[model samples]
Target: MSMNLIEKDRVATINPLKTCQPLGAMWAVTGISRAVPLVHGSQGCSAFVRYCLSRHFREPSEIAVTSLHEDAAVFGGRKNLVEGIQNVAIRLKPDFIGVITTCSSEIIGDDVIGFIKTAKGELKEKIGEEAVEKIKIIPISTPSFVETHLKGYDNTIKALADYVAEPSQPNEKINIIPGMVNPGDIREIKHMLRLMDIESIVLADISDPFDAPLRPSTTEYKPYYPKGGTTVDEIVDSANSVGTISLTKYAGSGALSLEKKYNVPAELGPIPIGVRNTDQFLRNLKKLTGQDIPDSILDERGLLIDSMADVASRYLFDKTVAIYGDPEITSGIARFVGELGMEPKLVLTGSKSQEFVKDIEKVAKETGAEIDTMIDQDLRSMEVYLKDNPVDLMIGGSDARLMAKENDIPLVRVGYPVYDRVGYHRRPIVGYNGGIQLMDLITNTVLEKYYEPEHWKLQQ
Candidate 1:
């Protein structure tokens, strides 16, 4: 059984793990083809969001801001909103502009939907009705004070479903909602779908846009937006897909919306990070498309199992770890560590989700490992907990780097905002290959710190 700790009363959180909503909204918008995220707030807000994303992905994150000032805050931001849309629509010429609200506009209670309508009409006059109609301006409300970035991503996706998706000609394709995952993870999921020969429309697919290779400017072409994302056409047609699979519970509102509006079957998540979770994903796909699991995938699974067996006793078994990150990702990793015969002593996340506790408890019961779980907590809390009850390793985002260093524990970086390291955005951590990579990383991290020269010699 797991001892789930509720967050104690505090005036404020220290070293809070999650970022704000607009960042998540901006991230989602980047996954749309030729889409630009227009922050409906101050320039500083947009800059922070862009800086955070650019640092993590190691790419130029393009974002626009309304540049709201004192006057706009006191009165209203309708003028700024209309002009921002017009400028972005004309200058950037983006197919979609996600107008994401921040605390400033949200707190003032700006009528964003109405302002968008007004902006559209004004754009019809400036850029012509035909051109204005071509660009879709979706308003996403994301108050930073209310929820974390995960909700921002969820809200943006749901807004897309509400405004864009339509019942159209039927298609055999299924919709995949990959929540807050790296580009490499998205590639892995796509690869698996390709192997299964199942056609899929991955909503907010950021793989190419985020991890795009550097291409020198040529006379023939110069890059603006990188060459990948879910096209607006694909999103509209998503309503007619056979089914929708949301890879994480944190960002499944869009899938749920599609199911409710268009009667599309929806499978909400346990993101496919670990073996059992991946199996569940495959099972869901099979149930939807009647496709059998191919031997190639089975071979990958076999390799993972064989590797686990080989390392279970020597380096992995009975190890203690502290896992923390986004709720769904943390839970999935906790489950995976259990599969690796590692006991997750403490699982913590800054996000407020009761489901996180339930999932951790389920993992504890399944693994027969006594665990301690914390939700809506910060790194400061995790550091305190680790001080009293030390663990062998810590699995989390780059934010935990300091804590791990102080505690002298090996940190296995996973999940979002890993700004301190590069190539993580380019590496898969979801599929069987991801399993092997993570297993190797965890084992090697431990061996590097704890194993002696004699231990290696004996093994040889």
Candidate 2:
């Protein structure tokens, strides 16, 4: 078994592994239909977020800023926030406005909740009671200094559940909370649901909004917003679902909230990234809905196992790999590589969680590899460690490119903010199909790095 180390007393950081919390909150809001994320802080904060999101998704990401001035910082940001919401509602006309608090706003102790209540009254007066009631204004507290982006996403999801969900007669549908994953992952989960003929309400479904299809129209009739996302009605109706399944442990707060409040059975994650994990997810579905595992899914699983068996002795078995990303994804990938008969040398994440340590330990026992786990550490630490004890390959977000380049190891890109390459968001690393793709990706990377030059001599 490996040591799960929580690096301590680090005064300085270089290239931290995670982004700020507000960005996460903004991302969650983007997954909702006709929703606008309004940052209750300076223009620079909002601009930075917009740039990061646009670069990653390669889409026109929209965000509104309160433009808090010096006066507002000293006294209060109530006036700026109210005006900002009014302008966004009247001009942009979004159905939902997620007011996200930044470091500046939170530090000043702004009463954002009170301000939102006040804004509702003012909105009723300005844009009629009926029209104003149609819009939902939810306030999300995301002070960046206190937490990572993962928490921001989780907090926003919980906020959505708290504000929108209303318990009624139970429905035949299940609620799927896909946490902090790519659009492709969500799409794959939806496909699995379809295969099972199970009805589901996916909370914060960003499959359509983030990876939108291009449509040509006249200049006068262009579509301003991408036609995608989980509707408000669906979110409200989620309370009546038979059960809720959260794909990521880090972002399962909403699922837990629903279970506690509305008695909805909640299945917290193993994040169906590998063969076994996917099996667990499907089994959970079968248990909850009394649906048998279909032949199609079984066939897919068989194919994945066949491929792994074919490649294990030559390409994948006993290879060493280091993975870093969000805690859940990192753990999931570690487990997948372990399942492929690979030794996971190091697994690291920026987020601080004891659950991550436990997960890694479990993986270590299952795989029987002495894995070195790092939590709440930056890439600089990872880079420093790799100088002495290098792995055969690295798997993480695009930010780990520098570490891979330095160590002369192949890198398999996955998880959030994969800005260096396009379509990473469009290809999943979840489900049975995702297992096949990931196995191919890893095997190909290994062959390309070590055996590609000798390929011409081999007979097909």
Task: Give TM-scores for every candidate, taking all chains together and pairing residue i with residue i.
Answer: 0.98, 0.97
lDDT digits (tens) for residues 141-218 of candidate 1: 899897799999999999989999999799999899999999999999999998999998888889988887778866
Report the Cα RMSD per candidate: 1.2, 1.6
TM-score of 1: 0.98
Q: Write the per-residue lDDT of candidate 2 for residues 1-460, one digit (tens) a residue.
A: 6655647457787889998999889888999998999999999888998898888889888889999989988998999998888998888777899999999999999999899888888988888999888898999989989769989999999998899899877888988988889999999999999999999999889888898888886564326667789888889999999898999888899999999998989999999999989999999898778778899999989999998888767778888999998999999999999999999999999988899999999999999999998888888888888898888999998998977987799999888879998888889999989998888989999989878888546636
Model 2 scores a TM of 0.97
All models: lDDT?
0.89, 0.89
Q: How far off is residue 309 in model 1, in Å? A: 0.9
* Deviating ranges (above 4 Å) for candidate 2: 4-6, 218-222, 455-460
What clash count does candidate 1 reach? 0
- Worst ten-residue run, lDDT, model 2? 217-226
